[model samples]
Target chain A: MRGHFNYLRPDCVTECLDMLDQYGNETAILAGGTDVMISLRTGVKKPRIILDISRLPETRQVEPYGETVRVGSTLTYSELIDHPVIRQEFPALCAAMGCVGSLQIRNVGTLGGNIANSSPAADSIPPMMLRDAEIIIQKKGSSRIQKLEKLIVGAYSNTLEPNELITGIILTKIKKGYRESYQRIGRRKSLSIARINAAILGRLNDSGVIEDARISVGSVAPSPMRMTNVESHLKGRKPELKTILEASRMIAQEIIDLVGVRHSTEYKQPAIAGLALKCLEDVFLDSSVN
Target chain B: MNLEIDFCLNGSEIRLSIKPWETALDVLRNQSGLTGVKEGCGIGECGACTIIIDGKAVNSCLILAAQLDGRKVETVEGLEVDGKMHFIQQAFLDKGAVQCGFCTPGMLMSAKALLDKVENPSTDKIVEAMTGNLCRCAGYVQILEAVREATCMKAPLNKDDVTNS
Candidate 1:
């Protein structure tokens, strides 16, 4: 807000990278503007150059790369949800994206923007984490791939350098028999940020035993974390009500131990457990029961 | 520095010089005199500044004026054709959905965006589309009724008419 800023819209990724390399220290990349616009108004980020990379074709492609899918970083939530691959293969991600903001927000909010903003409560991260997502970060000359969990250091913080831009997110495809669910508890049903949310992916063997499980919960710690402890407990166990309830309790306890006690702990503890129960139940029970 | 941008607004090509920090909402209401684009929450929380860009509804408050270049934008001011109320506007009137009138424009634009894509959207789809626009007067039931009526209206509210640009 202090200095006069230049709004530059680069036509391609290379041009964007070139501009970023030159003005890396004094630029703010604009993707969807859902988060960047808010920061600009609050004076949280004052940059000499507002780099508009929202329209680059290189960052908007959703192509299948062998076994995994590479989602262009700038693809909006609405666009991603509409893709047939996402709707058929990643229902948990679809639900998470649907839960974000609303239709208006989803129309413009990008998966890359959500990750770049690095909010602790970002709904997309938990689901992306469930799929073992990796980001492709590119600068002027070189690029690197990093795990999504490693990229986000803390609440609203990330390891992205000034010149680095997230170009694409690669998510492993779920094989046959895997069921996934995303559960969120917010202050309201619409346009509310997630207070506590979770994504659970589980698979049952032919014998009806939990063969594999992955759990990631958001808005509980510094960033959304994989509940490796609870996920390990669920593996090889019968997907029974008692087991689900016990696993849910373990997740609650794990978060409490990780975050320590706080004024909101009394509410968040039970809420987190309840969301876990719902997500687990959704993954393991809903289809069979129906 | 003021940057020159050209885009289609309400079926007409418009050229404007906008600053880097100027939002689409600010440019629409202040420079273009499109008061229908209201500014409720400077943030994206309130959908009062909702507008359709390139056939999708978005918070104009969150979009920079420079982003509007080479894009098609539609607002409530464009809902009337030949000075006649659009079918959606007629439905709102018949359903008595107007209470305070502040949120109506946003709601109508949201409805138009949905109807532009889906001819007769389901009830769940209607709720999903309009959830971003908040009516503090609690005029939701009537608003929903208006959208439902708009879908059932005999008037041919096709996509071509709404996407006039």
Candidate 2:
């Protein structure tokens, strides 16, 4: 707001990275700017230069890249919902995207911005984590990819460097037997940020045995976390009502250990358990299965 | 340094030198003289400042003017045709949805964008489209009814078309 910094509407990724390197912390990559504008206005983040990367062509593409699906940082939720690959391959992400405000907010909000901002309540995190998504970050000349769980270390915190710009996200495809679900608890039906959310993806064998399981919890901890212990316990076990209910309890226990029994714990711990059980129930007890 | 943004405003092309801090609402209400776009929260929460960007609706306060480099922005003023009331406007007036009128423009624009994409949208689609724009009047029931009436009208309503009804 103070300095007359050049507004670089870079048409390409290289130009944007160049600006980021030259400016470092003094520069900020402007995606949807839904969060950036709030930061800028409140002086929480006063970047000397606003790198308008929202217009970059590379950040708008969301197509299949071989076995892995790549989502551009600039692709809004509306675009994501329309993308055939996203709708088919990552239904949980699509469901989470649906819970992100209204159609208008989804039209402008970007997946890259969502992951980069690392908001604990970010609706997309749990779903993307369930997919075991990897984030692609690029600087002036170097590029690095990290699992999203590692990228988002804490609330409103991430491993991204000042000169780094998140270009795309890579989500690995699960097998045909894989079933997933995403659920959230909010105050109202619409336009509400989630209080607690859960995403569950489990691979079941022909014999109705859980081959592998991954569950991600959001808005309960400093960051969205994967339930490793519960997942391990449910491995190769038939995820029936009994197993799912017990696994749900284990998930609640793990979350309690991490987030501690805060004031909301009395409400949240039980709420998250019910959500996890429901998600597992849908996937494990699908009528489509032969 | 100066930045030039070229976009269609109220169905006309515009080119202006905008600051880095300027918002779409700032450009619409200030430079374009379409003051119908009001800034309620300045941060995208309140629907009082909603506008159509490209083909989708968004909070004008949340979008920077520099972001509208090659997009079409339609404001509430664009709702009228030849100084006549648009169908959505007539529906609002008919339903008595206009209370303080502060939220009327945004609500109308949001409704127009929704019905434009969906000729006969379901209740869910209508609710989804207008969800981002908030009306403090808590007259949401009337607003919802007005939007439904506009959607059912099917055609644009004229000024003379109002009194005959």
Q: What's the distance in Å from true for residue A99, model 1?
A: 0.6
TM-score of chain A of each: 0.97, 0.95
Expressed as tens digits, the lDDT of each residue in A1-290 for candidate 2 is 42344566788999888777878778877788888877876778767778878778988988687778988999998888989988999999999999987766788889999998899999999989977799999999899999999999999999999999999999987667788899999998677889889999888877778888898999888899888888899998886788889999888888888868788888878888998888888777772355
Q: What are the candidates' C-alpha RMSDs?
A: 2.5, 3.5
Pairing residues by index, what is the TM-score of model 1?
0.97
- Flag clash pairs in model 2: none
Per residue, candidate 1 scores C-alpha lDDT tens digits across B7-122 of 99999998999897888998999999999998898788879899999999999999999999999999999999998999999999999999999998999999999988987789
| Candidate 2 CAPRI classification by DockQ | medium
- TM-score for model 2? 0.94
lDDT of 2 by residue, B1-165 (tens): 668988888799989888877888887788888899998877777778888887788888778888887898898988888889888899999999988999888898889888878768888888888888778878888999999998778644433476678
Q: Enumerate the candidates' DockQ scores in order.
A: 0.68, 0.51
Alpha carbon deviation, residue A253, candidate 1 (Å): 0.3
lDDT tens digits, residues A205-288, model 1? 888889999999999898999999899889998888999999999999999999999999999898999999999998887745
Model 1 DockQ reads: 0.68
TM-score for each predicted model, relative to the true structure: 0.97, 0.94
